[model samples]
Target: MTTMFRYPVFPVLPGLGQTDIPEGLSRVRSIMAEPDYMDGDSDELIKPKKLLNPVKSSRNHQDLHRELLMNQKRGLAPQNKPELQKVMEKRKRDQVLKAQKEEQEAHKKRSDLEIELMKRRETLEQLELDQHKDDEEQENTPEFVKMKSNLRRTKQEVDGQERST
Candidate 1:
């Protein structure tokens, strides 16, 4: 037995291989193809021959240069007088206040820790005293003494029974 199959093939269009070029790109290409285009004589092209001089300022260059040198030597840029000083003083005051607050907090913590330690020591001493009192009370009790003797007697009786068995 033989199986036969047919596949469909689409025909290629005439304009399918052509792409639409933009008008600007075509104009740019035509301009670039001209022999005199790179000479930069046209107003549309930029010229590198034009030199732009820096605008002259009213201030003296030597003074500005000396000020820059001084600022560099000082390791800081020139700032307004009262405003910068006030800001620096405020920062220093804030730092000092923060340090004082931290020191006070640390001192309070230490005091609290010491107080807690003292309380714990007192509680431990009280517990020890109570334990000592309990021990003395137990020693003085007739019931505890009787229980000790009864335990010894019971142990002897159990040993005798085990030997007989």
Candidate 2:
């Protein structure tokens, strides 16, 4: 799409005349024409390359080379295990895992036994409490109260006879 540039036109009321600059106004330079914004020297534009310490790097490489050579002398070889070694390692790992599983099972059984004993103790305590309440209820019955009163009367009568004698 093309755009049509439109500018405002002036009538008699808008017929503006040339006006002089304001009393305090002065012409100023633009930032684009300043020296700082212009192209610089090629030498200044291209940065200098960084220097590296090749001697230190070579020393590190030499030390690593010597260490590898000494490791070969010390019989500290890299691991490329034979089939028999691999099989032995696998069996060792399996044994360790089986032992761990057995330990977990034993711990589970012990915890289960503890839980069962705790429940049994709670049930026994509840039964004893129920028995105590039943005994209290029985004592509160009319027959038990009458029996208790009769025993008290008989004891008093015996004491009175003994005193008279």
Candidate 3:
């Protein structure tokens, strides 16, 4: 048996044309829309944005760093005397002096080591000279020559004994 109740279907409506607009709701277009209400003069009153020129275009960090470095170079970075600033300056001075003292000590140690090395080298040279002089004297001595000949004669006698045995 067929069902008598049916599902409802919705119909699609066409879009409204331009002429379909109501006269009471007509669209308006302005020729001079208030010129965007610019605050250019107020911007001039404010601090200008720091622009990195082509000559210094690589300065990508903040301008404050450059300003501080320049001021420090000119000895103007530090403000009016505060106890903390005085303490920091004193600390820096102490650290610099300490570093200088340590460097001097290191230099002194290096100089002492050099002197010791020179003394050792001189002693070695003196020993070498004494050895050379002893060698020259031994070469010139008749007793040394006779002893060498005796050693050779003993070695020959031992060789002859070994061959005979």
Ranking by lDDT: 1, 2, 3
Tell me each candidate's TM-score. Answer: 0.24, 0.22, 0.24
Residue range 2-111, candidate 3, lDDT tens digits = 87757432222267454454456324321123333264555445554787576555565547568879999998855678889899999999999999999899777777
- Candidate 3: which stretches are off by over 4 Å? 1-110, 147-165
What is the Cα-based lDDT of residue 9 in candidate 3?
Answer: 27
Q: Each model's number of backbone clashes?
A: 0, 0, 0
Where is model 3 poorest over a 10-residue stretch in terms of lDDT?
28-37
RMSD of each predicted structure: 17.1, 18.4, 21.7
What TM-score, to 2 decimals, does candidate 2 have? 0.22
Model 1 clash pairs? none
Q: Cα lDDT for residue 160, model 3?
A: 100
Tens digit of lDDT per residue, candidate 1, span 1-165? 996657432333466422343335553453344556576677776555855445433357657777889998989766557687899999999999999999899777787779899899999999999999999988788997879989999999999999999
- What overall lDDT goes with each candidate model? 0.75, 0.74, 0.73
lDDT of 3 at 147: 93
